[model samples]
Target: MAKYSEKASEKVEESMHETKEGKLKSGSGKKVTSKKQAIAIGLSEARKEGAKVPKKKD
Candidate 1:
């Protein structure tokens, strides 16, 4: 497994919580229903904030 920064992990955790609460949404404005999607969203946010995260896969 790849190592994630503490901030990145926190963002992911928050996204997971939002997903469970049915409050997570996609860029297209659709509700997030998949765990993987939620994690991806969190990672994307972390990247935007300049957290120490790996580059997105092609």
Candidate 2:
């Protein structure tokens, strides 16, 4: 598995928790229900925050 920075992991964990609680939303204002989507969102946020995360796959 790829190593994630502590901040990145924390963001992902928080996203997962929000997803499980049905409180995660998408950019289009839709509710997020998929695990993958939540993780993606978390990574996106981490990127925005300048966290040490890998580049997005092509």
Candidate 3:
């Protein structure tokens, strides 16, 4: 099992909401439509904030 900090979890939740509302966008200026992409964005944001998120799997 992987462990995520509370802050990271909250960021994921926030990103999910933005995705559902059609407000989330990718680095290429494309609107995000996939749930997996949204989650990735959230984790990326959490990482930027120094949240305790595990490194991406290869």
Candidate 4:
């Protein structure tokens, strides 16, 4: 299992949160319709923020 810091976890949570309309769209203009995509987006953002973590390989 991989480990994530509190800030990383929070960033994931905030990114996955849906609006009242329940739409999941990433900032990159991609439609994130699944939890996996949401988490991926969050982790990607966290990585860009310089959070210490491993990057996922596609």
Candidate 5:
């Protein structure tokens, strides 16, 4: 199972909302975007805050 800190989870949730509200766009000029990117963004912020977030697998 993928483990994520509370902050990371929150970020992902917000990002998901943005996508749902049509506020975010993909690089391919599409409305559909990867949720992983949102998760990654969240994890990055969590890491900056020293939150306990798991490293992303390459």
Candidate 6:
């Protein structure tokens, strides 16, 4: 199993929450409707924040 930092997990959780509440949006300002997409957004943010997240796959 891959290890994600606490901060990364927290960001993921927050994004998931936003998705559940119908408040998550994509870069184009469209409402996010997929759980996977939400997770991706969270991870991307964590990466920007310098969290212990793995590098994205090509």
lDDT of 5 by residue, 1-58 (tens): 8677787778667777877677765556666466776556556767778877877679
In model 5, pairs of residues that clash are: none
The residue pairs in collision within model 2 are: none
**Predicted candidate 4 versus true structure: per-residue lDDT over 4-45, tens digit per residue:** 877788878877785223566877876677788788877887
Stretch of 10 with least lDDT, candidate 1: 1-10
Candidate 5: residue 12 Cα off by (Å): 0.7
Assess each prediction's global lDDT (C-alpha) against the native. Answer: 0.97, 0.96, 0.97, 0.76, 0.69, 0.97
Report how far residue 23 has shifted in candidate 5, in Å: 1.5
Against the true structure, candidate 4 has what lDDT?
0.76
lDDT of 6 by residue, 1-58 (tens): 7799999999999999999999999999999999999999999999999999998989
Error of 2 at 52 (Å): 0.4
lDDT by residue (tens digit), candidate 1, 33-54: 9999999999999999999999
**Tens digits of per-residue lDDT for model 3, 1-58:** 8899999999999999999999999999999999999999999999999999999989
lDDT value, residue 36 of candidate 5: 70
| TM values, all candidates | 0.97, 0.94, 0.95, 0.74, 0.57, 0.97
Model 1 scores what on Cα lDDT?
Answer: 0.97
Number of clashing residue pairs, candidate 6: 0
Superior by TM-score: candidate 2 or candidate 5: 2
Candidate 2 CA-lDDT value: 0.96
Off by over 4 Å in 5: 25-32
lDDT of 5 at 3: 73
Q: Model 1, 41: alpha-carbon shift in Å?
A: 0.2
* Model 1 regions lying over 4 Å from their true place: none
